[model samples]
Target: MLYLVLAVAIAGEIAATVSLKLSEGFTKLWPSVVVVAGYAIAFTMLSKALKMGMPIGVAYAIWSAVGVAAVAIIGWRFLGENLNPTMIVGLVLVVAGVVTLELGRMH
Candidate 1:
């Protein structure tokens, strides 16, 4: 399904981003490889989902937004990054926007 493909793309993107931080400016070998591979797979999956009839704008929006949120959570949990109340609110708004876009397409 297109949605599943999109989810995969988003997950890959998040993994890539998290690995990027661990890559330490590309000086780390394994994490650097992971970053590159994850991004490649993410883009490949995204292209496939687009070919499956999902609108580019919708797919890209969902992909980027979800990727951002997932990466933020990963950073918070694993990278000692902090999320203040404002940041949490902003993330919620992003989720709401994604939900609104999905709902709009249902009719």
Candidate 2:
């Protein structure tokens, strides 16, 4: 249940970030609306996750790491944004760090 909330938070954040890129400095209408709504949903869900007993350190780490990875993938695959080897390595490091964080929590 807590993880479900966190997943929603992550999805909302990813949507918000992707919409932000498509907003064209807020000149675009629907995408801009999505940016606002998505962030609202993201934060709301994140708060819910926290209230549901997810530690802030773990929740935020997962949320941010997943968001970063999803947004980068979307940008590269759909938005035609540059994603080079360096960025790939960086993303790998981010994922590894998040995994470490999760693993550390089990101890």
Candidate 3:
């Protein structure tokens, strides 16, 4: 359940980040609204996950890793952003780190 909440939180954070880019320095009204609302929802859900007994370090590590990876994909696909080989390698490293963290927690 906590992981589920964290997943939602990650989604919210990703959406908020993407919307932030779309907002164009807050020049657009709708994207700006989305940015604010998305962040609010993301934080609220993240708090709920923490309250549900998830270890802070583990939860944060997973959230940030997944959010960053998803954002990178989104940016590459839709935002005209460059996703070079180095960036891909970096994202792979992030996923590997998350896996390592989760495995460590199992012990």
Candidate 4:
């Protein structure tokens, strides 16, 4: 259940981030609204996950890792953004770090 809430939080964060880009400096109305709503949902869900007994470190690591990877993919595949090899390597490093953190928590 904690993981589930964290997943929802991650989705919200991702949507909010994408909407932020589409908001065009807040010049667009609908996207701006989505940005606000998404962030609100994201933070609310994240706090709930924490309250549900997920360690702050572990939860945050997973959230940031997934969010970073997902947003990068969305930008590349849907937003015509460039995704270079260097960026891919950086993402791999981020995932690796998160994996290490999660695995260490079992000890």
Name the runs in model 4 displaced over 4 angstroms. Answer: none
Q: Tens-digit lDDT track for model 3 on 1-107?
A: 77889999999999999999999999999999999999999999999999998888899999999999999999999988999999999999999999999999999
For residue 50, model 1's alpha carbon misses the true position, in angstroms, by 0.4
Q: How far is candidate 1 from the true structure (C-alpha RMSD, Å)?
A: 0.7
lDDT (tens digit, per residue) of candidate 2 on 40-62: 99999999999988889999999
Off by over 4 Å in 2: none
In candidate 1, what are the lDDT values of residues 1-107, reduced to their tens digit? 78999998888898889999999999999999989999998999999999999988889889988988888888998899998889989998998898889888887
Q: Write down the TM-score of every candidate.
A: 0.96, 0.97, 0.97, 0.96
Clashes of each: 0, 0, 0, 0
Candidate 3 least-lDDT 10 residues = 1-10
Which runs in model 3 stand beyond 4 Å of their true positions?
Answer: none
Candidate 1: which stretches are off by over 4 Å? none
RMSD, every candidate, angstroms: 0.7, 0.7, 0.7, 0.8
lDDT tens per residue, model 4, 22-74:
99999999999989999999999999999988899999999989999999999
Worst 10 residues of 4 by lDDT: 1-10
Record all residue pairs in model 2 with backbone atoms less than 3 Å apart, i.e. clashing.
none
What C-alpha lDDT does candidate 3 achieve relative to the native structure?
0.94
